[model samples]
Target: MSKERSSRILHGFISACLVAAVAAFIILAIPDHLGRAGIGAGSATKKNFPSAKNLSSIVDLEKEKQAAEVKIENPSGQLAYFKPEQVPIPPGQDAQAQDLTLTDPNQSPDVAGGSGAAVDDSSFGNAVPIEPEPTETFQGVPDNFVPVAEDTPRGSSITLVTYPRSSLAIHEPPAHVLRRSKKEYSWIFTPPELEKDVAFWKAIYSRYDKNQVVLHHPIYLDIIYDVVDLGYIEGDMRLSELEKQHKKEKLIEEKRERIVSILEMLAQNQRLSSSLNDEEWRIKKLFDNVGDPKKFQRAAEEFGVRAQIGQRDKFIAGLKYSGRYLGEIERIYEESGMPRELSRLIFVESMFNLKAKSSVGASGIWQFMPQTGKLYLRMNKIVDERNDPIAATHASIKLLRHNYNELGTWPLAINAYNAGRGRLKQAVQTLGTKDIAKIVKNFKHRAYGFASRNFFPEYLAALEVAENPEKYFGPISYDDPLRFEMVRTAYHISLPSVAGVSGIPLEELLELNPGFSSKVISGDQLIPIAYPIKVPEGKGSIFIAAAARAPKSQRGSIRHVVAPNETVNSIAWMYGIDPTRIRQANANIRRNPSKGEIIVIPFD
Candidate 1:
């Protein structure tokens, strides 16, 4: 056959097959579809209504009854598809009634003129009432449950507002770690971030052991408590009668026994001694009785054998101040999705000291380094937001959330806060695990040191001690939180001038706004435009009005020659300003302004 004839034959064959397939589909589907609509083959329709004349003879009552029974048998059928005129909609029902909306509005006497098969309106009520089932209860998908990256549009830019140069003139110093601590904690601050290969879990675990209470030198001091001896064993320090009252726990029982034994020895020694003073006799007898006094003293000096009484006393004092700001701290941590107990980290960091600063440049209660502090806080010559408890808490919250997001666990995230997230990430990826205990035990890196490994454990210890301060120490009195209102500055005004206008003491105003750098207060730099100066509550209006009435000359920057007894803090306090700003103004003065030094004080 020719090629053209072959193609035509193939096309005809394909067309015939298509027609057969379509005809077969219609044959199979027609019955099911028509049956659902109440119109199917072999299903004869019954007359539902009687004719006006000879109603009984016009309708077949038996046939209608059979049709109704069929509908009842197939409850799933679409009875709604039937027209009221074509099928009997039991009497007293509307022609447009839905399958579910059935009602009997009238009681007709069994269609009096119709045949005995007349539909009864009340019969429809026997059918079960169908209520639309509640849409499958929708529990929304969680944020992390799905792949968000696939759904989020790429390359979206978000705007962030920092301090406005136009509204507030700010002079930020070069970013560097500013250490302002009184004591150096050689152990706590020397550790590096956790490493995958470092195995320091044993050391880290020691801090978390509830039964083992370890004491070390504080970052703020270099002293250790004196050692004492009991009948059975020696203790680092003697506990007072009040201290004994709180030492009832089983874990503390052993330590308490040792302490009680030492007290008994001290009492016996005191009774026997005739030459020495009470203090001298106690010391001499303790040294004479408990091994060698010189040996114990040297050991304490070298190893921080016991927690210093002065330091602990200072901590107890710090708790008093913590009461003032704990609420705000908890609120910040909670809002940031961090555990509220983490606020106790501040106690470990700075003993809740707002003015605390480390030699390495970490500052404030959160101990943020200058570089990190600048990320969330305004760290400048005129203002360091880290000094503001509320501001620093906010910054700390943001940093902690970022840490948690990156590390996926609180311990690792908290450790990242001290050691840096990049190192933790590298350690986690290298080790293929984020378990803090495992990482601490096995992780090894050049940068991972004692401090980084111990950070989380130290936080846990701090949290434990802080939660039960009354247990560790005696009853404590908390400082009330500082309350103040922020008042905006229209122009550069002197800190002293602010005090004068607000009718508040210069010391009080300066205490209220520790965030202001001394330069802004001392007339070296103007209190930047629109800078909010905090004043005692209810003093905002009076201060603003007073500031306006104050002479322009008083509000401008001034040159002051430091005099005798004029330290930076004292000078700053004199002017209602930040001492840091003053130190910034005079680069030569590293910490305090020396006597006879020339310093410029900025008016705000």
Candidate 2:
């Protein structure tokens, strides 16, 4: 066979296939063409399927495509077929549904089927559901948002939070309270205007990348009143005590913020001596640093910061104590090859009264609180080394050493000792400079806490008076460092019991056991077995031996609780009694009880 002849034969076959496909489709869809024009060929009547020629002439494909689908369920029955065409979209709606779709609704008699089947009477158990459009009039939005044309996509449902951006600022209030009373008329007062303006003002301030003033539009003066807080003045702030100093501090803060505000207002109003950016930068830097920029500006404009804080003997005393401690500390000063007199800091802190307790619960000559003392010193039911000068001094030294290791500066270390290290570090970081005065004025940061703010100045002042005590106090007596003998008990014991046995005063015994409390020392717990036992200079060994026995009168051993800053020997001698007798009475009196308590005092 020739190749050209074979190619022609293939083309003829393709043409024949296309023509047959068209004819077959027309023959199948004849019934659907008849039904939509108010006629049905594939109706219940059997004759509807044959010769449905009138339906084929009026068919419109585009209109049929635009119509929505319809579902028709048929129960078990004889096969039926129907054909319809040109189904239009329903009135006031885009489309309608048809029950069924068939490739050929009206077909030749050999094919038995109905294109759009009707639901049977027995098949009524199943139902189809249709959804309706939602109803909500969303106000404040562009109104022409409905879907009108066919095939248009639906838009998203509107919601409250998803509303426009410009509506954010006034959407809700921070807080509100409502009250109803039978005794009075209904009344409503809005929140004071002050906080709103301040927050808004801060928002304005935040707009600048490295400067301020982006937009400026003021409401009434009343709105400005909302931003200002004069209540901080306390209205009737007292001028006595430290009140004057406090008022000055508060005023300084106000003036500082005002300075920033003024510079911003001036630059924005075009009333400045330099570029707006320059003024802004200066104001912001001043805001970030210590001292009131406003005050500094005023001072620069007027005179200068020439005021002095007048000399105070108390301040001198504190500095002197600091110097004294610098010369005599045990672990940090002596052991670390540092100055020994540094031990005098403890004296400045608690006036060398081992039993002194501060308002904050700080105790001992070192003024270590209960928890802090517990950490470094052995403090138990029978022993608290914080009262003992040698023991507490060692603990203080160790504590200072730890602080120094963490913070290189001795001044900062001292600050950390009084104020916790965390607060000191926070203040240092906030001020960008480790200036003590700056830390004092930071009301927001914990660095401004009463104790922490005062700690540095108080410590420095302690050093001053310690150097020359006689200058402040007339010829202050020199009390020698106390001494004691090491006495070991074979069993559990109380000071009063020991006093009764030895005919020694309980107060005397208590003075020796300065580190103990509860008078009852258990045999098991860690306690000074050979604790420093003080006795009269001429007392014999027989007296000490006799006091070692436990007795009832001595069981509830008592010691004169020497008031703060009182001397143990002085109290003992005051009662015309031996000091050893008191020590024996209260075996557990750790540190001398400065606030005098009943003690086993000997007769004169």
lDDT top scorer: 1
What TM-scores do the predictions have? 0.44, 0.37
Q: How large an RMSD does model 1 have?
A: 35.4
Task: Report the error of model 1 at residue 223, Å.
Answer: 19
Tens-digit per-residue lDDT, 483-560, candidate 1: 554445434455665464335677778787777777655644445333446666544444544444333312334556
- Angstrom error of the Cα, residue 197, model 2: value is 36
**Alpha-carbon shift of residue 441 in model 1 (angstroms):** 3.0
